[model samples]
Target: MTLAHFLHGLRCASCGTLNALWLDLIRALVECHQCGQTALTLTDTDEGRSL
Candidate 1:
């Protein structure tokens, strides 16, 4: 999967730490690298993430 967009220096909602957004497969997700927590998950495809 390739990154469609990235929010550099963004804050995580779950961990309250700086994070980056990346595209995994068809899903756009944000994880706190410091805390290893998934802060958010969004559908990157027209029908959402799929196998």
Candidate 2:
């Protein structure tokens, strides 16, 4: 997805920068652009919780 489609409100664990999350659906990874940190890994249980 484009940068405009990045998920906001997420803070980078390494850099403490906010609004820097990029969700990669294929890999089920949520990463921070500012610090290159893998903040979250989407699991089957997480999918249910979001809804």
Task: Return the top candidate by lDDT.
Answer: 2
Worst 10 residues of 2 by lDDT: 1-10
lDDT of 2 by residue, 1-51 (tens): 433248877677788888987887766677888778884464585656763
Model 1 TM-score on a 0 to 1 scale: 0.40
After superposition, the stretches of candidate 2 with alpha carbons farther than 4 Å from their true spots are: 1-5, 45-51
lDDT of each: 0.56, 0.72
Clashes of each: 0, 0
TM-score of each: 0.40, 0.60
Per-residue lDDT for 30 in model 1? 55
